[model samples]
Target: MGLALQGEKIARNRFTGEKIENGSFMLCDFSGADLTGTEFIGCQFYDRDSRQGGNFSRAILKDASFKSCDLSMADFRHANALGIEIRECRAQGADFRGTSFMNMITSRTWFCSAYITKSNLSYANFAKVVLEKCELWENRWHGAQVLGASFSGSDLSGGEFSGFDWRAADVTQCDLSNAELGELDLRTTDLQGVKMDSHQAAQLLERLGIAIIG
Candidate 1:
C-alpha cells in the first residue's frame, strides 16, 4: 500500500509481516508497534517532512524477533531512536546519513553498504554487529560498547570511539584519520592501510611503548 501517513499515530499496532512500499511516514509515530520481519522500500522512518527528525521516538518495537528483513534505501535521517533494539536485522543501504542517534542499541545487526556518515552515535551499544562496506565517517561514538563486532571495508575516518572498549572487534582496511582511539588496544588491531591523524600519532606511539625523539 502506498500509505502517506505523515505525522500520524501508528502506535500499538501489530505490523507483523507487513510489506511497506514507497511509504512516507515522516514525523509519524510508530512507537509500541510490532514490526517483526517487516520489509520496506523507499520508506522514510525519520522526521524528514520538516527540518526536525525522529518519527518513532516514543515507539516500542519489542515484539517477535525474526531475521531476514530488508530495509534498504529507507531514510532515517535525524530520527529519534531512544530505547529501540535493532536486533538481528539486515539494514542494507538504509540511509542513516547525517542522523544523530541517542541511546541506540543494535545487536546482531548487519549494516551492509549503508550510509551513516556524520552521525552522533554516543552512548550506544553495538554487540555482534557487522558494519561491512558502510560509511561511518565523522561520527561521535564515545561511551559506546562494541563487543564481538566487525567493521570491514568501511570508511570510519574521523570517528570517535573513545572512553570505551574499542577492541573485541575486527576493523580492517578502514580509514581512521582524525579519529579518537585513546585507551584502545592496538595489539589486536592493525594500522596498515589506515590513515592516521598527526595529532593522534603520539597517542598511538605511546600505546606501542615507543617514545618520540625531538
Candidate 2:
C-alpha cells in the first residue's frame, strides 16, 4: 500500500521525515512543500496532459531517490540533497542552490541550465552528460568525473576541478579564474575564451614543461 498523491494539489504540505515509498505524485502541486527527511523512493512526479512538471522548492530531500521521473524546472533551493539519485529523468532548468550534493549521480539523464550555485558537489559525477550553459559559481567538484562533457558559457569561477581529465572535455568560453586545477593534463584540449589569471597561465605552461622567461 503506497501513498497516492495523483492529480491533487498538495502545495505547502509539510510531510517531514515521512517514509513515502512507491507513491504516485503525478500531476500534483508540490510547490513550497516541506518534505524534510522524506523518502520519495519509486515515486512518479510527472503529468501526461499538462506537462506542468513537479515543483520541489525549498524541500529537504536528503537521501531521496527520484528515479524515472520528469522533473523539468523543479525548484530545489536550499535543500539538503545528500546522496540523492535522479536517474533517467528530464530535469532542465532546475534551480538548486545551497544544497549538499555529495555522492549524487544522475545517470542517463538530460540536464541543462541547472542553476547550481553555492553547492557542495564533491565526488559528484556529471561526465558524459551535456549539462551546458549552467551557472556554477563557487561550487566544489573534487574527485568528480567532469570529462567527456561540454561546458560552454558556464561561469566556473572559484570552483574545484581536481582529479578530472580536462583534455577529454570541451570547456570553451568559461570563467576558470581562481579555480583549483590539480595536475590536469591539458596538453590537448579546447581552452579558447577562458578567463584565467597569470598564475593559471603559469600552471598550464608548467604542465607542458614550458617555463616563463624573465
Candidate 3:
C-alpha cells in the first residue's frame, strides 16, 4: 500500500481507509483531501504538500511539514516529527506520543483531548491554541510561547514549562504539580479549581495583588 508521486498534485482525493506505508511523496499537494481513517506509516511528505484536513495513524512523518493542514484527529503515535511545522491545523484528538516537535510552529492549532506524552516541544509557538482536556505528561515546553491558549481540565503533571508564557491562558481545573512555570505571566489566566502546591499558590497570589511578608 504505497504510492510514489514526484512533483504532482493530489487535491480533493477521497482516500478513506487507505493504508500508505513506506512511501516517498516529494512535492505533492494534498489540499482538500478526505483522508479519513488513512494510515501512513514510514511515509515522507516533503515540501509543497498542503494536506489540509487529513487523518494519519502511527505515521512516521520525519522531517515533514504537514503545515497549514487540517489534521484534526490524526493519530501520530511514536512518530518522529523533528523540525516539523504543523502550524494552524485542526489537530483535535491527535496522538503525539514519543514525537519530537523541536522548533515547530504549532500556532493557533486545536489539540483538544490530544495525548502528547513525552514529546519535545521546545521553542514551539502555540499561541492562541485550544488544548482543552489534553494529556501532556512529561512533555518539554521550554522557551515556548503558549499565550492565550486554553488548557482547562488538562493533565499537565511532570510537564517541563521553563521560560514558557501562560499569559491570558485558561488553565482552570488543571493539574500543575512539579511543572516548571518559571517567568510565566499568569496574571490574566484563570486558575480557579486548579491544584497547586503551597509555593505555587503563594507565587500566584503574589501576582494577584497579594503581598507575602517574611
| TM-score against native, each model | 0.50, 0.48, 0.52
Q: After superposition, how far is residue 79 of candidate 1 from its true place, in Å?
A: 15
How accurate locally, in lDDT, is each candidate? 0.53, 0.62, 0.55
Candidate 3: minimum summed lDDT over ten consecutive residues — where? Answer: 51-60
All candidates: CA RMSD (Å)? 10.6, 12.6, 10.7
Candidate closest to the true structure, highest lDDT: 2
lDDT of 2 by residue, 94-144 (tens): 555444443334665433434445445554455554545566666666655
**Model 3 misplacement above 4 A:** 1-6, 46-112, 185-189, 196-214
A best-first ranking of the candidates according to their TM-score comes to: 3, 1, 2
Model 1, residue 20: C-alpha shift (Å): 16
lDDT of 3 by residue, 90-203 (tens): 344344444433333486443343455555566554555556666666667776556666778888877777767666467888898877766655555567888777777678
- Segments in model 1 whose C-alpha atoms lie over 4 Å from true places: 1-111, 188-193
User: How are the candidates ranked when ordered by lDDT, highest leading?
Assistant: 2, 3, 1
* Model 3 residue pairs with clashes: 53-70
